[model samples]
Target: MTATTRSNEPGKRSSSGRMIARVVWMSIKLLIIPVLCVAALIVGLAIGYVVLGDKPLSDVFDFNTWKHMYDLVFAEGG
Candidate 1:
């Protein structure tokens, strides 16, 4: 009696290959949260402009917005 081994089959992955794939997948997952937060901030800023109903669309990306945010967060109360 002889045993025959088959190398080609479904659901088969080498240990190193699987580890590399897992690392790549995890890295992508970790990056998604920060990316989504930034996207949400941009969306919120745009929405704020619409809600205010006065600012121009370009203001959302302007430096003044960042400066104002910084001041608002770190300003000393008189």
Candidate 2:
């Protein structure tokens, strides 16, 4: 049997460990999109709640409220 020697390289990582790290990173990257979308939805709902301050909380989800807000923001000035 022959003796094996290991190098003391500073940045050396095992192949399997590197693969596992890559997969974990990819998973986080994939999950971030949906997380961001949900965050945006919550923020939009908060904005709608403020816009419809006197109405019920559930009313923030109403299509009419969104439509009215959209129109107010995008209406052409005459």
Please report, in order, the local distance difference test score of every candidate based on alpha carbons: 0.88, 0.86
Number of the predicted model whose TM-score against the real structure is largest:
1
The local lDDT score (0 to 100) that residue 34 gets in candidate 2 is: 100
Q: Cα RMSDs of all predictions?
A: 4.3, 6.4
> How much is the lDDT of residue 14 in candidate 2?
82
The all-Cα superposition gives candidate 1 an RMSD in Å to the true structure of 4.3
Steric clash pairs (candidate 2): none
Deviating ranges (above 4 Å) for candidate 1 = 1-6, 68-78
TM-score of each: 0.65, 0.60
lDDT of 2 by residue, 1-78 (tens): 999988779799888989999999999999999999999998877776777676677767788988998999999999
Instruction: Show where candidate 2 strays beyond 4 Å.
Output: 54-78
TM-score of 1: 0.65
Model 2: lDDT of residue 16: 95
Q: Which tens-of-lDDT digit does each residue in 1-78 have in candidate 1?
A: 999986776789778989999999999999999999999998988988867757788877889887998999999998
